[model samples]
Target chain A: MIKARVTVTLKNGVLDPQGKAIEGALGSLGFEDVGQVRQGKVFDLELDSADPGTAKQQITAMCEKLLANTVIEDYAVELL
Target chain B: MIKARVTVTLKNGVLDPQGKAIEGALGSLGFEDVGQVRQGKVFDLELDSADPGTAKQQITAMCEKLLANTVIEDYAVELL
Candidate 1:
């Protein structure tokens, strides 16, 4: 089996309220050195195929179709 | 400035309803070759510190205190 790790994060210039909340929480906890905090999503996928190429292709298609909002977010896929 | 990327994922034997939903969604979309699907959280943090060690230490503390549950999830921090 081949495993793929996909990270989907908001594109630059996008507003992230969750991230802002985290940053505020960190600040309240006395982590003044902390700067920007952006929250994203990760997907760990197990594929029945051993071929990395095929797995990557399928995972990419999944990301494009459902996993990520391509209009405001970007996704990176890593085959493991 | 130093940046840290933290990934928090469910440990083995833990139930992930979100992942199961994704798996079912994929199967319905004709991606039967896809097997297990685990969903995780990602944090992109920008720190004002230049020292990698200090940034890592603080980020680890952040993970332990607020970022991860630690009871059912494991978190990995990567400095970028």
Candidate 2:
């Protein structure tokens, strides 16, 4: 089996409310040093296929279609 | 500024409904090769501090206190 780790994060210039909330929470907790916090998504996928190349291709398609909103987010895939 | 990337994932054996939902979605979409899909959270933090060591220490504390549910999730911190 092949394992793929995908990280989907918002592109620069996008406003992230969750991240802003986190930053506010941190500041309230006295972690004033924290500047900006951007929250993202991670997916660890286990594939039945053994070929890394095919797994990557399929997973990339999966990200494009459903896992990530390509209009505002970018995804990176790592084969493990 | 220092950037700290924190990845929070569910512990082994924990049931992830969101992940399961994604799996089902993939299967319905004809990606039958995908077996297990685990969803997690990623935090991209920008800190005012220049020292990596201090930034890591603070970020670790953040993870323990608020970023992660230590009982069911494991978090890793990377200073970049």
Candidate 3:
């Protein structure tokens, strides 16, 4: 089997309310120096098949079609 | 001001229920080959002060103290 880790993150200039809320939460936790925050998502996937090339292609398709919001976010993948 | 991106992830061997749920979602989305999944958190922070040394120390302290549940997750920070 093969493993892949994919991360999806909003593009610069996009508003990130979740990240802003967390930033506020951090300040309450005493991280007063934290000026701004943006958040991203991560997915670590283990594949049933072992072929790296095929697994990557399938995973990329998954990200494009379902796992990620391509209009708002960009994705990166790592194989393990 | 300076910026840092901190990613916090569950340690290997820890159960990731959220990732599992997402894995199930992926299967429903037609990713039948996905065998397992794990997830991580990302924080992109802009610091109040510009000094690299101070910003790094503060962010590290925050991660250790509250931003991450250290007992369950490990964290890494990148300067920006």
Candidate 4:
């Protein structure tokens, strides 16, 4: 089996209110040196494929079909 | 400045209904060879520190204090 990680992050111009909230909270909690904070989603997937090439293709298809919102978010897949 | 990524994932045996839902959704979408699917949170942070050691330490502390639910979730920090 091939283990894959998909990280979905907001695109450069997308607004992220959750990230802003976290940044504000961090500052309140005394972590003052923090700069821009962006929050994203991570998916750890186990695929029943031995070939890395096939697995990556399948995972990328999965991302396009369901994992990521392509309108405002970008996704990166890594095989582990 | 140092850039960091913090990933928070449910620990072993922790119930992940969101993951289960995604798995089911994937199966319905025709990606049938999938095994376990775990959903997680990722934070991309920028800290005003040039030193990796101090940045890592600060990030870990942030995880312990806010980013992760220590009782049921674990977090891993990566400097990038």
TM-score of B-chain for each predicted structure, in order: 0.98, 0.97, 0.90, 0.96
Worst 10 residues of 1 chain A by lDDT: A50-59
Give lDDT: candidate 2, residue A48: 99
Candidate 4 backbone collisions, by pair: none
Off by over 4 Å in 1: none
Question: Candidate 2, residues B1-80: lDDT per residue as tens digits?
Answer: 99889999999999999999999999999999999999999999999998889889999999999999999999999987
Q: Candidate 2, residue B57: CA error in Å?
A: 0.7
lDDT of 3 by residue, B1-80 (tens): 89788888899888998988888888898889989888998888899896899888988998888678988899998897
Residue B51 accuracy (lDDT) in model 2: 84
Supply the TM-score of chain A against the true chain A for every candidate structure: 0.98, 0.97, 0.90, 0.97
Q: Stretches of candidate 3 above 4 Å error?
A: A28-32
What are the per-residue Cα lDDT tens digits for candidate 1 across B1-80? Answer: 99889999999999999999999999999999989999999999999998999999999999998999999999999998
Candidate No. with top DockQ: 1
**Interface RMSD for candidate number 2?**
0.5
lDDT of 3 by residue, A1-80 (tens): 89788988898889999988888888998878888788998787899997898998998998898778999999988897
Q: DockQ of each model against the real complex?
A: 0.95, 0.94, 0.69, 0.92
Which RMSD values do the candidates have, in order?
0.6, 0.6, 2.3, 0.8
The complex in candidate 3 yields a DockQ of 0.69
